[model samples]
Target: MTKHEDQRLRIIDRRTLWNGFINLEQITLEQMMSDGSTARLVREVHDHGRAATILLFDPERQMVVLVRQLRLPVFLQGESGYLIEAPAGLLDGEAPEVAICREAMEETGYHIESALHLFDAYMSPGSITERTSFFLGRIDTSKKVAPGGGLAHEGEDIEVLEIPFEEAIAMIRTGEVCDAKTIMLLQWAMLNRAALSG
Candidate 1:
């Protein structure tokens, strides 16, 4: 392990509890005892959160499944009403694969067989405190019927959309798709798609 990894494991008794959504103890920030004249400071933070996103790839049909939903934050940035994104959700004590599969069923109504983990990364290190684990799943679109939005009580008004795998690539080129996590997963698919599909 490198110095950064060593620093990351230096947390002392971090506490995390659930009080509705999620509540975590504020990490105590300490100044590194480096010999410098009031200069550089290294800060390490421990995040008590997790997120999961799925790129639904139908190998047989050459299509990718996505969902359109209204995101107020994006709308406030002067965009359209609906944002196209893959089925994703926060890992509320559930495993990443389990959470993503459940989200796929709720958002798109397709029951997934298994999800393959692509990679894990942080989302916006400048501000938000969150890490996302991305997964790629080979879905069977043959059994897929009409789209299915999630339950209303969860405030999810999602609309399922299935597009050609190539078309999803085109959306990234035309700047139609702007979601960061979705873009990353799609790019990864573009690179290792043949192996993933086979």
Candidate 2:
């Protein structure tokens, strides 16, 4: 932030509210107003660190590999928790590329030679502290070293789905594919399909 922006807010205290699978922090601070005044505010930030997500596409087949798995949070919201999404996982102190590759092997059983780095994004900035690195990778069936069904111990009973590009995109339109990360990656592929094929 700029020097003028620095005058905007002051942090009074920061405390941890909860720390488990996810960390929650309460920040007591004040923000400056346009009228040269400050407003006190307390904002809670859910810190889950960062993550990496990779969209694996087959240029020749014009298909993508996704994982269908249950999300408890979604289920608790009275919706079907089975979500189709790109391979993703927490960084866990590893580099984004390394994390994505590990998650890919664990979830889909594919060993990728390399992946193209896309961008970094905040899934939900309103209250979450997660910033996910995005990537794209090209793969074929020949690269499958094992049956891609996810790890058993992690409670990951992932159902690997390989669908045509058009079908995957259509699923988004009809609400079949509702995961935000998956949707974003699919749209990106659509825009860069020709380049990817080359």
Using TM-score, give the best candidate's number: 2
lDDT, residue 182, model 2 = 93
Estimate candidate 1's RMSD in Å: 4.1
TM-score (C-alpha) between model 1 and the true structure: 0.80
Task: Write one digit per residue (lDDT tens) for candidate 1, span 1-198.
Answer: 765575423443444433344453444333344553232333344454788999998888899999999988788988886899888988889999999888888889898888898889989775346889999988888887546797799898998898998999899989888899999989998899676675
* Residue runs of model 1 more than 4 Å from their true location after superposition: 1-30, 33-35, 38-48, 145-147
Q: Best candidate per lDDT, number?
A: 2
Q: Note the Cα lDDT for every prediction shown.
A: 0.80, 0.90
Query: Model 1, residue 9: what's the lDDT?
Result: 38
Model 2 has a clash total of 0
Worst 10 residues of 2 by lDDT: 1-10
lDDT measured at residue 164 in model 1 versus the true structure, 0 to 100: 94
* lDDT of candidate 2 over 1-198, digit per residue (tens): 775468677888999999998899999998889998889999999998999999988887888999999999989999988988999999999999999999998899988778889889999999998999999988995568878788888888998888988999999999999999999999988888776765
Q: How does candidate 2 score on lDDT?
A: 0.90
